[model samples]
Target: MPSPRPDVHPPVVTGIGVASGLGHGKDAFRQGLFEGRSVFALLARPGRQRGDGSPPFFGVEMPDPPSILPPRVERTAGLSGRAAVAVLDEAWREAGLDRVAPERIGLIVGGTNLMAREQFLSLRDYAERLDFLPPRHGHVFLDTDICGLCASQFPIRGFAHTIGAASASGAAAIVAAAEAVSSGRVDACIALGALQDVSALDLQGFRALGALGAGPVCRPMDRGHDGFLYGEACAALVVTRPELAGGTIYGRVLGAGFCADGCRGPEPNSDGQVRAAQDALADAGLAAADIDYVNAHATGTPSGDDAELETLRRLNLGHARVNATKSIIGHGLSAAGAVEAAAVLIQMREGLLHPVLHLETPLDEGFGWVRGGMAEHRIRHALKFSFGFGGSNIALVFGAPEGAAA
Candidate 1:
């Protein structure tokens, strides 16, 4: 089948919803980014500790979103599902998507562990007490039920898919939604995803791998970089054809490229990243020189950031303004890409970019790092990178409103 021409049917983002450690909704998240303050506190309860007997690591856990789901079904939906419902309501409301028919709308959910939290909690509780307290009911304990539950609460009636591709899951979901809309499969589609605070399973796993940071703080790409802290966040985006757009477009998903690194271990090479960036440029019919800036997937890991920085140099994107936000907002696992992409769209819309947090020493001399404070620039076109653990790499190209300030 021949590829559809975007010129004839362009896909655009009409609305956004976010609930993260920074705060709830768009304004709160943007304000937190502007301040460049870290909201991380001592783990509310407790997690694994350093072998040296330091206090357990710090993390940020987002409070439950406004209660919008029916109590009966809410009990069975899991935290991920509940978060998705709240954000989808916000995005759907803002986009005026109610006018669209339920049958024409599509829903896609993404995350590293779509049902990890629910499954873990249930089994852990049972193991703690062999004597059963109460029996579980509905789909709350099942990951496969996420898609069906979301279909019932929201107007989405078309295809419902759950994508689990590690950290790039959310971005992968967005790429799929864009293709669905661009191909005329649906008038609009919502990409929803959420990650619970780092689970004991993940904490112990990353810690055993020596991936957690020693300092309470995390500095992405810093010379003293350690590792990432798990952050809780839920985000949703509404993508629809330009003709059906109800609100001003936040940005256009002009092009997307998805690839794999084939890395057997934690650290990966830069070749796959460079390839993904190249594919995005080609898909958008653009050149490396045409791009304005990049939102890097630097999650504060030394090896990962090193490889990503090398990829930027190889692509000759050192001149482009690049910002790493993981320092301000801890990595949200599969939700990182979607949330970070939202931040990029916000920066493009505002013409101001946030500075890297606590980055005193530089890791690479080639990067045009936005440090000290926010920087203002003419950003018409930008790039968003989503590189996940286990070698998944995705690149996305975003553009501001046409005929607007460059």
Candidate 2:
């Protein structure tokens, strides 16, 4: 028997699938980005204890549910879970994971503050009268429940875990999976992330904190930016060493880092964010000037956007053309990082920079930005930012395909 080589380079992203308000797949997401469409709509669920009996709220629902789902899995996971399964299935088939060794694969799913409505409703209906488990009880409402179900479907034998780091959850999952492969724990793995519709409690909380954008539109990076619009979405990527990629390689996940914001409620600062960005650049053996573009975690919030802007100005990333796609797709909570990463890869592949909608008034004159419309430019290295509540900040750096221009 020959000894395994154990790939030495950081894992690359070969396949991406998304179920978001923008659309159901990568193509739809790309189009949505180019067109700069805002999917924010009235939240169907009324806000509880928001002063007004039914507070005016904004959100984006999954444009479409999984039409073709495994009967048992569909019934088991419900809406949010099904959304995750749908994207995972697409990524699995896209990556040709069928050829990979079963035992050399792992699965990691992330969700920040998810409590699957379908799962909870089912539990309540069946167990309301029982002191314990009911005869017709379903899976309990846990963010990690989706990981076990995904692993079973894939028959993954290596390892599996779920991350619950609020908005950074998805990015954390991807980082963990990549580290696993980079460290020889697995040959390949799937990083799946899903954010279901907002719960009443979340809505009330955001409303209390004034984090939800009041207008129906999300205007990230703009001086008028107020806050982010909620969105339901799921995105998955098949991550493996570059030598093992079997499909159209989107881009390489070269480096990643995260940090905690030590600020109080609703207040965002730049020190921690800059550290994470610097760490990612260091991990990739690159400098601020090497980043050709940056997908910012603007979130349309005043404080959040201000903090990120300050972070960029402090880092002095002169070559990066920054943009925020949440102006179009809304914020996906835990799924935000993965979804934005997919957009970055798409932009790199197509050699064009997508625009940020409603960016009439730029916040700062120090950093370059992609405004107005899509700009045709090859991206060599891209940096993505994902920050969640409690000051959780994550930065991921991706490089374009070999031979591509920066």
Residues 146-249, model 1: lDDT tens digits = 67777887777888887776888888888888888988999999887655435566676777777777557788888898888777777888899988997768
Instruction: Pick out the ten consecutive residues of candidate 2 with the lowest summed lDDT.
Output: 1-10
Q: How many residue pairs clash in each candidate?
A: 0, 0
What are the per-residue Cα lDDT tens digits for candidate 2 across 292-402?
899998898888898888899888875579888788878888888888888899899999989988899888866778887988988998999888777777889889877
Give all TM-scores, in the order shown. Answer: 0.93, 0.91
| Segments in model 2 whose C-alpha atoms lie over 4 Å from true places | 1-8, 45-53, 119-138, 263-265
Every model's Cα RMSD, please? 2.6, 4.0
Q: Which residue pairs in model 2 clash with each other?
A: none
User: How much lDDT does each candidate structure score?
Assistant: 0.78, 0.78
lDDT of 1: 0.78
After superposing candidate 1 on the true structure, give the runs of residues whose Cα lies further than 4 Å from its correct spot.
Answer: 1-8, 45-55, 128-138
